[model samples]
Target: MNIAFRNESLPDKLFTILNGLIITVLFVSVFYPIIYIVSASFSDSQAVVSGEVWLWPVRPTLEGYSAVFNYNQVWVGFKNSVIYTVAGTAINVGMTVLAAYPLSRKDFYGKNTFMILFMFTTMFTGGLIPNYLLVKQLGMLDSVWAMIIPGALTVWNVIIARTYFQMSIPDELLEAAQLDGCNDLQFVWKIVIRLSGPILAVITLYYAAANWNQYFNAMIYLKSQDLYPLQLVLKDILVKNDIDVAMLAGDPADAAKREALKTLLKYSLIVISTVPLLLFYPFVQKYLVKGVMVGSLKG
Candidate 1:
């Protein structure tokens, strides 16, 4: 084997060096906050409150995580969030695929009209009050269905999936399937879906991430604390600063302790809340860029 180097022009070499520098800066800008937050989460409460921790933990301790997990509702919220994210994402992807497959087919009647209808929704919608009333009328408020059913699909995702199918799935393949006695349903389930892994991964990531972070809908539609998602629970704990008076009353520095712990918990809570999605993303990240670019090509 032999190695060779193309003697690049001076201008090209300079451009390459500059591009590398820019990319490094961008990476650092994005990564630095995560490092700071993780370090702060593990540092002592006073250190976190005083901003003494930066790239590394100062007086490192697990007090913040202990306080956060000690709250009983944290587990409940975790369970509910898992349920919502998994169920909601499943519904979202299923609906998007069902809609996109038909629209991708040239022979599907009223495709243009359906496309217009879906696109029109992106531009306008029935007012919030009406949507609320509709949900209330349907008896979905304060239920798990309220979280999953209302947002089962997005118009933008439908368009992307449709574009991916149109561009990637060939008509000749469908024709070949038909000649082999494959029905449309069998073809979609067996062939189309099997080949559509990239698009599926992209949409699954989008839906799963959205569902995990859902808070506003839970705030509006839920009346029971037991049904609250992790975001809402975190809000009450971190943002609202709800704490037990019994625990605070005995100590002379209780007020200061509460404030310090609150500061510490903020960072720990963020790490806890985002850990699932952070873990999940790397598995699907390889497909994300390719899926998004190819899916968005025609539309």
Candidate 2:
């Protein structure tokens, strides 16, 4: 029974078919790499190296995962990463809000001058060596502040947040808050922030991701391995191949066991590093999308 309504236009049908094919191709291109990585991570190193792993694992094994879990430094890196993400994100968000709110205010004096100074920083800088020297002079090197203080606020985030405040938070609300004897801090805390979920989520995700993925800063500033973030740890494991060969060595079947293990470890490292963000994204997905829209559009 073909009871469903259909527009009997040939062009429309052709367009629909073309669109679906293009979307399918795009999805496959995006998703296939992820599937391949997962499969290769689970597959035996030999199978992975021989290009046997495809959409599914070939000669499935847990050696890669076992290596990642058994490594003690991975845990230390994970802990440090969590700390950096939480603390750095807090500093970033707080500084961004403090900067943005003043700029958003119509009565704010010298906002243009301040904005120009901030934007000027985005275009020009003292370069990396000078920045490093400044951090050293400030005694932030090899310390937690090295991660947070240097990148306390982002200019782009400030602009987005300022725009969001101007467009989203009504002046009438501020006036009402003032009428009710609310001070600037009180109004910001009680009214402005409460109304700004989308932008907050957007910025939080941005800062958190940046902190979590930060390795270059830590690599340059921090000397102690204890202070190393997950990204730095990952760089060691994947790029440097800092793995113990005690177990993988002397295996009867595999001659290049250590090299094979390194290949497997690469995939496992990627999955372990990525899983946290995958879990975190779903909770804030709606807000993130809305925030991007609000930040992108001008009112």
Candidate 3:
């Protein structure tokens, strides 16, 4: 009925239909797993074990969540993870901005040398033993600083942010600001940062997600269970099957139900760990594509 469709050839119509079908199939492939996980988390443990859950929760119950919350370490791990994500993301974003701003400036000296050094680190790193010894020497072992300080800034993020600044903030704008008595620090704080929302959001999301999911660092550096992040605690449950059977079920003799409860707990923990990032992404979703695109562009 539309003018555009009216002019389309039969082959063009067929291609459009085929493309839509493929996209629909891909969407379902990605989306169905999320639905299944959520459904299984809420479903009765027996229903989950029996594979009764499909699109919706069957005989839905909160037992899995109840069991999760009842574990004191889960709460402690969650609290620690939140602290690490917030503090680490703040440091990461701040350091990235500082590094990127200087590197982005055309007049800055030795930027090429600094960029080469940065890229070199990405390709090669000090081995685990050396890294452990360094942390120990710094007195950061078994401390919260161990989690936040070691990976305070990411080099790849610095490059992305530098490119964003180069593409979006013209050199003429800097000259104009300087003429108006704006100092370098003031220009960065007021102008560059304020105008660089998309890239900032992109890097913030990246750093936040990384800090939240980090576990290997905690495993290596922290001796205290109190310092463990949510992901580490999840690793214990999912990989090692470390959950106590008595905590989930009142009757320890009920082996089948306990096994089912364990499976349900895994699903619940996954949902719990994932929900924060899922909630966080929507707030910055609008910026992600635009930021990645503009930041990728080079002179």
Top of the candidates by lDDT: 3
Quality of model 1 by C-alpha lDDT: 0.87
Locate the minimum summed-lDDT window of 10 residues in model 1: 243-252
Candidate 1 backbone collisions, by pair: none
Query: Which regions of candidate 3 deviate over 4 angstroms?
Result: 1-8
Top TM-score hit: 3
Clashing pairs in 2: none
Candidate 1 deviant stretches above 4 angstroms? 1-21, 243-253
**What order do you get sorting by lDDT, best first?**
3, 1, 2
Looking at candidate 2, what is the lDDT of residue 53?
81
| Per-residue accuracy of model 1 over 1-299 as CA lDDT, tens digit each | 11222476778778878998999999999999999999999999998888788789999999888877776778799999999999899899999999999999999999999988999999999978898999999999999999999999988888888888898899999999999999999999999889999889988999999999989989999999999999998888677877554432226566787778877777888899999998989989998887778655745
Worst 10 residues of 2 by lDDT: 1-10
TM-score of each: 0.90, 0.92, 0.94
**Deviation in angstroms for 288 in model 1?**
1.6
What's the candidate order when arranged by decreasing TM-score?
3, 2, 1
**Compared with the true structure, what per-residue lDDT tens digits does model 2 show for residues 164-283?**
999989899889889989999988888888888888888889889888998899999999999899898888877887766663433646657768787898898899899988888888
